[model samples]
Target: MIAFFLQGLAIGIVSLIPGVSGMTVAVALGIYRRLIDSTKNFTKHWQSSLDFLLPFWAGVAIGIGLAVRLVAYGLTTFPFPTAMLFIGLLAGSIPLLLKQYWLATVGRKQLDRPLQLLILVISFCVALILALIQLNSPLSGLSMTFPTLWALFSLGVLSSVAFLIPGFSGSLLIMLLGFYALLTTRLMGFMHDILTNSLYIDWNSFFFVITFISGFIIGFIIFSHFVMAVVINYGQLTFASAFGVLLAAPLAIIVCTKALANLQGSISVVLVMSALLFLVVGFMTTYVLGLYSTEFTREHPHQGS
Candidate 1:
């Protein structure tokens, strides 16, 4: 339970990065299949599913809550070094991905490696273009109306579809729909407002949350079974595309963050050394976690839990 909670925490924190995939993070932690299984059986086996999922969801909530404040501060205060740290963390997952997929891919000599290469290149370009476009997209302002409500529902539906595929950035898709900016502002705004003594809540914001989540839950359950079918039917190609997106995502992070641009000409030795140090720290952290997760999943599979 503690391990599941920690895995959720890490997923939530890293997932805050633009263009990063929460599903990829879950896969790296060795819990993606268990999560899908839990969700699949939740209706029929509510008790056992709750035992496995409760702590995990709690960690996700807290992780995102803390990351919201901390990332905002770090990005504003120590932009480049902070960005470097996250980039390193994102890059660190590549080794784990390679270890998991590359050998299997190579073993299947009949599979079209050339086609996979094409997918890798194409997906990389697609992710890069989306990130660049989103960096320029207007992200703030929302009004509660019929159209807005419909839009939120549509976003929820699309998010459910995007989230199942590793390396597909559901947040990036949300941004493309023109709601990402206002959605984030409202979330953080509500947090600030709720923290005040009055505990006042805005009905409009509350309604939006309920509507979006409603659509998400509906879509999630309906699509969960189908997604695994797609993955199994098109395993190598699917993962190849996923790897491409994963590779391009770090570059997207750099562009979206403008971390280097935030330096203000203070490119000192201290900054360089500090950036490198943090990068190594992020790398080692994921490397170790990914390493242990492999062994842990084999010895203590989540099925019995």
Candidate 2:
């Protein structure tokens, strides 16, 4: 239980990274389906799976609470360096993601050249668009506005649902909704306020959190069901689309890097070195944890579905 909870904390922290998904880690770990199923049938598998999953979810919630603050502070204070680090993280993971897909389904030699080229082109275009969107948009100020809360709640639900779909990126969805930075900042502020006793418990803030979490639960069930149906009935197209998006994501991050307002000083060099180090760490961390999870799955193989 402790191990799984810690694993979830790791997964949650990684999910905060752009171009990455907690689901990717879950999939690599061989428990993606089990986690999805357990949550889907909470009433049925509550005793067996909930004990395992709940702790992990709690860990994830807590981790996200802390991470949101850190990520926000870094981005606001050191935008260029932070962006560079993320670029390293994204670049390192791209090959692993693509190669795994090809090896699992069609070997590299077996792919149709024309179709592959088409996918590559599509991926590039998608990446460019996503990058441009992030770069061009002004950072929205934090707000307690009802409309803003509704948007935040709506985006939270959408991003959460994306988690249930194998290749969908909740972070990307959050980016599109323009609440990625805002949510992180507000949550960070909310927590700091509570910890420092600077402000009373804000009912309005609490209300939105509850609303968003409820929406996330409802959305996850529905979206997971939708994705399952698609995977079962139209897996080829589904995978192709997912592959296209995954391939595009790193490109998106790279393009977004160009959108950065270059900072003063030789700091870019320092950022480059630091980012590389972090990428090595992130890659190796995922690889080792993934191996452990895989071994665990082999020992406790799932029963017939």
Candidate 3:
């Protein structure tokens, strides 16, 4: 339970980054398959599934709540360093995922290397194109009308699809749909208002939030089932495509960092050093966590079950 929570927390934090995918972090932590399997078979394994998923869901909620404020502040105050840290985290997980693939196919006599390569290329291109589009035009600040609420719900569903796809950034999708700023602002504001003065509640904002969350829940469940089915049938190809998208995530972050820096004008040497330090720190953190997860899984093979 504790492990699940920690994994969920890590995923939640990483998911806040524009170019980082929570599913990639889950894959790195050795929990991706377990999560999908549990979700897909929840009815048959209700007790164990709840034991594993409850804490994870709670941690995800808490982590996202905390990350919104922190990440929002970081982007405004220290965009370069923050971007670098997320980039490092995304890049650091590549080795572990690749090792997982290798281990799964260790004794295979004949492998479809060409098909895997093609899938990888296609996935990378799709992710790269999406990232490029986000860099060129970032949308924000839409009014919260009934139509906008429906749009937000639709965006939530689409973003949830990205969330399920490794290396695809859900936040990037939200931004592209022009809902990122409004969503964040409303969330932060709602929390603040609730804490400060409970009587002054914004019903419209609350409704929009609820609608978006409902859409996300519906989308997550549907996508999880779909992904699990695909994995069961085409495990190797699916993982290969996921690997390609994961590889491209860091490049997307780098592109966004450059674009953001340009918008902010010249960067100083001190800032560059700070960003580098954070990048290295982020890389080492993810690498160490990956090692721990690998070792843990080896020892407790049936942990989630």
Candidate 4:
């Protein structure tokens, strides 16, 4: 129970970062398939699975509850530094994912080395080019308004779709919608007023939350089930493409983050260091949690060969 909650909370926090994905973090924590299986078979493993998932879901809710403000403030006051930190973390974690996927193919004598190398080279080059471009990526500079409720709902739906997809990042979708900052601000505003006055939740804010949650729930459940089915049916080719997209994402974030002009300052070094620290933390957390474990063959009983 405790482990699941902690893991979910950690994943939830990671999901707030632009380039990071809760799905990846869940995979890193060794719970990706388990969660899906449990969700699908909610009848059989209700006791144990719910014990693990409920707290994790609660943690996700809480982390988002808190992050709604902190991320907003960070972006508002120190956008570039914050973005740089996230980019660094994203860059550091790529190798870990690569290592995991590589190990998954161990014992497969039929696996083509050339094809694997080709995929890696192509992914690396594409990521490099994307990194260079994002450094100067233009901003929309758009703000959210009450009249834009439909737009916000739509953005939430899109983000939810990404969240459900294996290699996609909900935060990246938020960035694409240009409301990355706007929604963060509104979330903070909602939080501030909530604490200032008892029983005074903003109806508008509440509606957004309800709508976003609705979209996220509907999208995540349906898409995850479908994707899981596909993976079960076609594991290798599907994984290769998924891995390619995953590799491409952090590169995109790194590029776009550095492109922001405000990234230079005295605190930049410290921030970068902090980001590196978290990057290491992310790697260690994923590694130590048995997320990248290559010894599950006996238990899962798959023919890597």
Candidate 5:
């Protein structure tokens, strides 16, 4: 149980990274197949799975708590540099993601070239539009508003479901959609209020946090089932769509400077130079980590069903 808990903790921590995949983390931890079976057959295996599931999820919850605090601090203190790092992570991981998929599906009729191209274009366009929408709005810019509640709710669903997708960084998708910082900050503040000033808490903040969290919980239960269906039915197209999202994300970030208005710097050269360095750091961080995870999986394969 302790080992399972630690594995869950690791997955939770890596989940915060836009480029790191929870599935990959689980694979590295040597529990990918068990985790999937436990999830997929919870009803039939409830008695057996609880030993793994409970402690794992508990660790995941705590891990998320710790990581969110770290992310919230970085976003609050160094918005531009931090985002650059995230973008770097995204950029670095893309190649690794492609490489793995290529090796796994080579000569396997992965995608119908013409249809794949069409889906890819559509996915890119949609990703860009959503990225721009989130970039210009209440959550992405961290200027939360009641009017954007519905939009935030929609994003809430994506946030909860993103981690479940294989080799895909849901956090990265959420960040590209402009909700990562806002969600983390709001979550941290809500947690702080619950611990420190329960009575004097701001009702508005409370409502915002509660609403978003409620949506997350609901989304998880409802969409977990939905994701499995889609993946089983259209796995290849799903990958294509995710690939498109990944491709458009960095471009979206580059175009959305106003979203980073909170960046503190009067000199463009210094800031740009700093951002470039952070981007490289982010890229290398994910690339190396993904490489290690891949090698680890290859060395010690688990045959869980």
Candidate 6:
């Protein structure tokens, strides 16, 4: 349970990155299959699945609650280092994914198959296009109204779909839909108000929050089943596509964060070193975690599910 919570927290933290999918982190951590299996088969194994998922959900909530504020502040104050760190973490996970791929396809000629190759290219291109679109789009703040609330609910559903797809970021979709700023700002304000004065709350904002979360829960459950079916039927193809998307994520993050643009003019040696250091640290952290997760899974293959 503690392990699940920590892993969920890690996923939540990384999910803040524009192009980084939390599901991708689960994949890298060697728990993607277990997560899918448990979620999809919850009816058959409700007790065990609930025990496994409860802490994870709690951790996700805690991580997101903290990350929204911290990431907002970081983007405003220290965009470069912050972005570089996430980029490194995403990059580091790639090796672990490749190892998994190699293990799964060791005796098969799957990668050489034309259909698999096509799927990989198509997935990569689609993710690239989506990332570019998200990067170029402007985030217009939405006013709280019935229409906007419905839109937010719809966005939440779409975001859940993105969450299920490895390397597709739900937050990026929200940002593209022009509700990212409004959602984060309102959530922060709501949290502050609750902490400061719980009795005098804005019911309207509370309603919006509840509606969005409800949409996410519904969408997540539906999409989880769909994803589980895809994985079971086409494991290699699905993961191949996911691998392509993962490969594109670092580039997307760099583009979205404008990190390259910041470094283009009069690059300082100290700043460059600092960025490099942070990147390396992030990479090492995730890589080590990946190794640990791999070992843990091997030792307790059926412990969680």
Give me the candidate number with maximum lDDT. Answer: 3
Q: Model 4: residues >4 Å from true position, as ranges?
A: 43-48, 103-158, 164-166, 198-201, 235-251, 254-259, 263-305
Candidate 6: which pairs clash?
Answer: none
Clashing pairs in 3: none
* TM-score of candidate 6 relative to the true fold: 0.79
Best model number under TM-score: 1
**Residue runs of model 2 more than 4 Å from their true location after superposition:** 103-127, 142-147, 197-199, 202-208, 232-235, 254-259, 262-268, 287-305
- Please, what are the lDDT tens digits per residue for candidate 5 over residues 1-305? 99989988978877876655676566545576577567667799898789899999889878888888876666666667767876787777676556544543443445577887787799889878876776556353434576667667776677777766665677766667666666676777777888786777765556666776677667866766656555444556666766777788666654443426655456577777887899899788767756755542363232111
Report the poorest 10 consecutive residues by lDDT, candidate 5.
296-305
lDDT of 1 by residue, 185-206 (tens): 5666666666774467877777
Displacement of residue 152 (Cα, Å) in model 1 is: 3.5
Lowest summed lDDT over 10 consecutive residues: which window, candidate 2? 296-305
- Candidate 5: the clashing residue pairs are 88-283
The positional error of residue 130 in candidate 5, measured at the CA in angstroms, is 2.1
Comparing 4 with 5 on lDDT, the higher-scoring candidate is 5
Residue 49: error of model 5 in Å?
A: 2.0
The residue-by-residue lDDT of candidate 4 on 1-305, one tens digit each, is 77887877887887887766577666666677777777766678788768777898988877887776666666666555566556554554555445545445565454576775566567556555645544556444433465566666666777876665444568865664455655565566677677788577776666666666676776666665675655443344444654665566654554554434455545567666765565566446544544354333333334332
**Clashes per model (N, Cα, C within 3 A):** 1, 0, 0, 4, 1, 0
lDDT of 5 at 100: 44
At residue 246, give the lDDT of candidate 6.
67
Candidate 6 lDDT tens digits, 194-217: 879877887766776777888888
Winner on lDDT between 5 and 6 is 6
Better of 3 and 4 by TM-score: 3
By TM-score, rank the candidates, best first: 1, 3, 6, 2, 5, 4
lDDT of each: 0.69, 0.61, 0.72, 0.61, 0.67, 0.71
